[model samples]
Target chain A: MSLFVQTLSFNYTKRSNILNDVSLSVAKGDVLCLLGPNGTGKTTLLRCILGILKINQGEIHIGGRAIRSLSARELAREVAYVPQATSTVFPYQVLDMVIMGRNPHLGLISTPSSRDEEIAREALTKTGILHLENCLFSEISGGERQLVLIARALAQQANLLILDEPTANLDFGNQARVLMIINDLARQGYSIFMTSHFPNQAFLVCNKVAIMNEGRILACGSPDEIITDSCLSDLYSSSIKVVSARILDKPHKEVKVCVPMLV
Target chain B: MVVAIFFTSFLFGRYPVTPDKVMAILISKIISVPKSWTDTMETVVLQVRFPRIVAALMVGGALSVSGAAYQSVFKNPLVSPAILGVSAGAGFGAALGMILYLPWVAVQLLAFVFALLAVAISLFISKIIGGSSMIVLVLGGMVISAFFQALISIAKYIADPLDTLPAITFWLMGGLSKVSNNDVIFAILPITISIAVLYLLRWQVNVLTVGDEEAAALGVNINRIRLVVVLCATLMTAAAVSISGIIGWVGLLIPHMARMIIGPNFQLLLPVSLLMGSGYLLLVDNIGRSAGSVEIPLGILTSLIGAPFFIFLLSKAKKGWS
Candidate 1:
């Protein structure tokens, strides 16, 4: 249950080098929080790993097999991706939206199997939205919408779940609820990989942390090992500040504040 | 439900043939048994009218199903068959073939080919400009539509005012007059096959509702599948248009009606739209033929009735979905 990135690279437009020779490995039962400054290619890296963006150089290997060696369908069976945000241009019921995750498992023309229905229901329940199954997608709150999207990825039944900015848009309470769900899923043996700017969040939940800057991995270690005063200060040299807080028995974190150092 | 509508509609047409009379007519026509078969009743019940009625039923269903498929792929409720320049391209191709003295089959085939070519060119242009962007895909459809309409206008100007002009006018307006047994034979095969393919692959269409990248991630090949679906939808719509001439409103109106009734799954929407489309067209065609001393063109009859009903539908639709 390890996700490996080997020589992964990507391009945007005709211009090359959005991601450059970036590689990392996440072990079984690990929550790897990808911490990066803005425009550090966090979302691009996720797309390349998911096979949505074709690699210009090298390969992504999942469990010792090249990503190119597996069919898109086969690879999708191994990985589930939740994007930053999605807007349903057409208004559809929440149940219908959640059931779209059953796409890979169901036949081209066939209805969702009873097993798919059961799995989808369980995913919804895990995300704490089984009661909101009948609600219209457009009528839901943004945090609820994000949970519903997570429920969709969970329904894919992949061993590795990749999320892009899972809590980028949410209140403090909602963000914690989302992070708690991810932590619970990791405990249930699903490998969680996500990107975050909130170093505090990574310190609380992720056992392994990778900090990125300008399309390169600047540091990769455990939260306490990778984050230091100089590294955190240089990471945000322009206007740096740290606010310490202890949630008593929960978790304590040194949060970075203000604009991050880009160079 | 499509089956139920087909039989029920047959029972309730202008000349209401009783179930017993329908049986007698079927038997007499099969054996050519000599009896006092009045020519008008015989022609109405068997020869001239039956094929036209069946053709309308099939073609109307084809267009509506095509529209539903397009709406899903384009991810826009406003998309229709004509929006992709498909209808206009096929119309112009058929008109040119008819004016040049081609046979009906050749004309229909040519029309189908050009209609597909129009969509292909638009797809390619979208790829070149805004690769895989939804707004780019729709804008490409709009440009292709306007370009084909300019061609249609040119074709109308060059035709003979007396002979070709009225013929083109009638064809452009759409009707059941040109429907023959050969046309029915020709039309139903491709139409049935395309609709069957659509029904078989309808669930893949659900992926499109979420957006393309999500669809591609789910082991779905977006480009390959889009090509096949567009070809099938275009084939059904083009063949239907070649026979019925540009029947307006069925493609535009029926998907909305069906979505309202059965929800948004193509499993239900496809069949329901098929039934509602032909039934609505049949009602309009009946009025076109039987309303007065002179027969009005079917398109005019449809629009005249369709416009008011559509406006009423529009006012109600605005408050609910958007």
Candidate 2:
């Protein structure tokens, strides 16, 4: 397994536990999408697994080694995180921002050399953003910024990738583009652990889906078995439906979509 | 450009030395040139102008690099080297030294020590107040600065109006007129060390700009790196203020100019800021020395010159950063 969590529980205060016995694992080349509603501790779980938040109970292991045993640099080399895209105060060029991912690979005093730049360029090219290499990050569109962040993660050269709401601020077409990129990365043998609000996104790219509700993993299995209409309704506290249909003029390929019902 | 300005500064002073004489004096120091230079010329070049020029360059470079480092670590472009109360603390210390009739070295030492103390207090208060949010740090700095500013007022109030008050006021205005070789030597150690530390850690500083959570996710020990960068910047700010007595604008202005020219990459921004800062201040100092019969103080001249130039740069630069 590339990333593992066992019986992880977390709480900011003694009275209210933010996460309770949450357990999940992702192996090499697998796509695990954590589906939940707002305030359901989805981000908390991701933070705990990333070692940003210390869990009060249980353990997290990256590549079978206890996460606590590794320094930040070591853990960063094992897993890469792509945060939601936000505008920066400084107008860092797209290339400059991507090269920051090489932080884990370089020494304390070492800077990104030509070799590192070459790697960053390759990552940008992989994400189809090589043309925006010189553009200021602040000037880029939200979807382009999201792609830039993924390129940054690719430059980290880690085997495991963690994404938080990768499609949150993007338009529908941009959202599909991001999902396609995530799916391609998984097919290329990178393990991905992602959190998303849209359950339908799970059917598109994720093989395994976990529905979280009220700080607990209510269901965990393949999307076909776990992401039913009722499970998503319970997870989000709303009426939702799961339906299968042909997408984009492809008759043989069936796609599943989860839509929130109107009251 | 900096080299051109540096040599040109030698010709503008009161005891005018021709460009050829300046070159001869400079080349004579390195190798065997004839003893054609006068003793007064030698003293003017070697003893007076050399130390003054060196002090201006060092102070300017130190402040600019310190400001850039602080802004990156704090994740606020509006922040300057003095944001943590270092200048106010140093100003109070210098005023107290004048009131006590202390020596020049004692004044410098006290200022440097209090500058560190002010930052330590700011950080401590922020820690006590709870989270490590940027707002808390900035607020803590404001409180500490106000505290030190009040202390400076007290020192000025009680000081002898005849001698100590004017001296304190003059020092507070900031100038390099009294900068001796000893002062330059003392400030160089801390300033150079801080600048080197910032330069070596410049790339890591970039990681810090993405904010705390992202920085930690990238495997940076945010607290440790912040402490180191803050300490190094504080040391440089303290050293620069101790020698030159709170010359403003170079720290805040040069980094922006550098960023406008080189973009936001600190590895390049830092070196560029250092060079631009030194050259800008050296040119300003030359103007201060020769502009009128009575020499203008550096503190007044930097903003008088820096503000308009910065505005011009802002107008010409692209609209990217908000």
Candidate 3:
């Protein structure tokens, strides 16, 4: 099953609407990349979907259950979210930090199970950071910490993984690596929904793209169909163009989410 | 670990008894052996030093656990029970109680109530400034701390200098003197129960440290969890400050020390903190009684020792532990 929101809307200050009549269906194993600039309600939409923010005028259904009807743990079992990167105050070891994802699956009386450790270890191994498991998270590099966050999400074992700015502070290699990881996970049957400022990254990784602007979806379609000069020009409110590119001098790249402007 | 602390305390008091004798006395006491009609060592083990030892253990565990919880709730590392003004405010109340010649139970309860009042005022001020945000709570804690310190100063200024002043001063310094079985039971029972309860929900505390929104996203009832944690933590803190009269650094330093040892999982950190805190307090108490005829206050001893050890640990470890 997949998650769907019907006419979702949220207002800030109970006056101006931040999300207006947002409707979307995320099918199983679908990677829906929400491309938007800052304050375009991308994070707000994610919060509404995760039940962190209340939807003012519409309903959100996850796995055929209403968002409000499901318990927090039950909802967590369905949707795992990776939040924006903020500094951790304490010097918690990586193992302890990742093990917190097992909380939703546990009973009130049970501690983290052996299965939880195996899952965390597998996630860490998959992310190629298992060697750093004993090290403190605060002392890790930004890229490694980003991977640790993904591993924590993987340990959650939810079907739908949501991430906000997963590669916000990463270098070029780590950004590509994070996108590659998400692409691989999607191919392996995990539904991924993420927001990103890098439109090209979304073009390289996402199967479907929805561009949002001013609290509204400007366009939603396949990358090649929606990543057009007209849409980019209107969404970013600037002159933009996407040209064909070559890989090894073979004219093959057709869908480029490129926005080259000198302003 | 508590058992380890209890045994160490029983064996290493001022009236020195062998570990073997301490163990034998403990076994006889538990097994109901016929009373040793003439052995003073047995009385020392069972009656005189045992209550003091138990009191220190409870106070240490209670204060440190409260510290851990408050640190997590406030999302601030430097916060302790005293930051919410409970400890200092309770000192003021206890000083007032002493001046009034109130009974011991009455004085203890009065101090405990005043501590609760102090925390309530902090909570109220946090609300007044749109709390549930980390910065606001931290500010509220600072304000409450300042307010209570001023009140304590007033009490000190007005209290009779000869009898009450000295008593009040020593009480604020924290000692295991005047410890009784009843006081131990009273102080420990609530704290033990609260610690157990908080331990069961320890992961929530770790989640809270992440943030309110992120924690809410993880399916925690953010407000409810925060409230429960704060109440349970402050309750134990009030109980502890009432009995021990404001032991300081155990609450501030023990959790961080335990984090260094076992990492920062609250599940492991909780038990380690309890054990280390109890053990350290008992050790300091032993040193205090042994060093001089006049027993040193446990608070002074902890600050005197913990501060230097903290600086030493900071210097030796060069990676991200400040």
Candidate 4:
């Protein structure tokens, strides 16, 4: 197993818990998608796994070692994060932005060597953005920025990638592109964990799916097992329909998609 | 440019010494040349001009680098060294020292201590309020600044009006005239050490500008790095303010100017700001002394000159990368 969590609980105040008894795991080369509505403790669970927030009760282990025992540098070398795109005040170059991922591998006073820069460039190329290496990051489109963020994670060279709302602000075409990248990364033997509101995205890319509702994981299984019409409707507190549909321009390769039914 | 300005400044003062005579006096210190220049010339060159020039350069570089460091750590391009209440705290300390009839060393020491205290209070306030957001820290700074400013006002209200009041007023307006070799020597160590520390950690500072969550995600110890950088920056600002009172605008403007010339990479920006700030302030000091018979205070002149030049640079400079 690349990541394992057990009975995780968190609370910001004395009034109520934000997350209670959430447990999940991801093995190498597995893509796990977390599906939930807003404020459903998806972000809280991710923060707990990242060790940004100390959990009140639970245990998290990466590669069989307890997460609490690992220093930030050691943890960072094992798991990389791709945050949702936000505008930076400074217009750092795309290459420079990617080069920042090398921070975990460097010493306190050390800087990125030419070799590190070469690796960053290689990551950018792998993400199909080599042409935009010298462009200002602020000038890039939302989809390109997402790709750049993935490139940065690649530069970290971590086995497990934790992405928060990777396709949140993207257009339809961009969403497809990002999901494709996640699937490709998973096939390359990397462990991928991501949160998304789009139910069909779970069907599209994830091999494993978890549906969270009211601060807890309501269900966890393969997409076909968990993303049923009744389960999604219960998770979202609204009527939903699961139907088979053809994606892309291909005549074959039909896939299941979830569509919300009006009240 | 700083060298050229330094030599040119030697010639432009009210008691004009010719360029060759200035050069001879400078060289005579290194080698035993004949006594061609008058004793008055030697005294003006060595005593009056030397310390003033050094003070201007040091204050300018220290303030600008501190401003740059603060801007990065706070992740706000608009922030300056004064954003943390250091200047207000130092001002209050200096006024209190003056009221107590303390020596110059006591005044400086009090200013440095109070400066650090003000930042500590701001951080403590932010912690008590319970958030890691930058806005909380800034709001805490503003509250602490107002508190210190009010204390400085009370000090001014109670000070003896005859000699001490004018002295206080003059010190507050900021000038290099009162700087002696001893003051320069005292301020240099802290300023130099702080700037050196800042330069060494420039890459880490760059990582910080991306914001706290991202910085922490990248494996940086955000709290530790920010505390160390803030301490060094506060030390430099307090040392600069101690000797020159509150010379504003240089800290706020010079870093912007440096960023305009070189992009916001701190490895280049920090060192470039040092050189650019030193040259700019030295030239401004020269203007203060030679522009009229009465020397204009540095605090007034920097704003007077800096504000318009900044507007002009804004018009002419490139967009947002800085």
Report the Cα lDDT for candidate 4.
Answer: 0.89
Across residues B166-269, which tens digit of lDDT does each residue of candidate 1 receive?
Answer: 87777788888767878888889889999999888887876767777777777677776776788788888988988888888788788877877666777778
For model 2 the local lDDT of residue B252 reads 93
- Reference-based lDDT, each prediction: 0.79, 0.90, 0.81, 0.89
True C-alpha contacts between chains kept, each model in order: 0.57, 0.71, 0.51, 0.46
Expressed as tens digits, the lDDT of each residue in B1-322 for candidate 2 is 9888888877878897778888899899899898777889988988899889999899999999998898888878889998999999999999988889999899989999999999999999888885667788889999999999999999999999999999888888899999988999999999999889888888889888987888888888888888899999999999999999989888999998899889888899899999998998899999999999999999999989999988999999864756
Clashing pairs in 1: A235-A261, A236-A261
Candidates 1 and 2 compared by TM-score, better number: 2
Query: Which ten residues in a row are the worst by lDDT in model 4 chain B?
Result: B313-322
TM-score of candidate 4's chain B against its reference? 0.95
Q: Write the per-residue lDDT of candidate 3 for residues B136-236, one digit (tens) a residue.
A: 77678678778778878888888899988888899899888778888888887779888988898887787767777666666677788788888888889
Model 3, residue A170: C-alpha shift (Å): 1.4
Query: Predicted candidate 1: interface RMSD?
Result: 2.1
TM-score of each: 0.91, 0.97, 0.93, 0.96
Higher-TM-score candidate of 2 and 3: 2
Docking quality level of the chain pair in candidate 2: medium
lDDT by residue for model 1 (A180-255), tens:
9999988988888899878777777888888887787888889877876667676655544344555556665434
Best by TM-score: 2
Which candidate, 3 or 4, would have the higher TM-score against the true structure? 4
* CAPRI quality level assigned to candidate 1 from its DockQ score: medium
Q: Which stretches of candidate 4 lie over 4 Å from their true place?
A: A247-251, B27-35
| lDDT (C-alpha) at residue B240 in model 4 | 91
* TM-score of every candidate's chain A: 0.89, 0.97, 0.94, 0.97
lDDT tens string, model 4, B90-114? 9888888999999988987888788
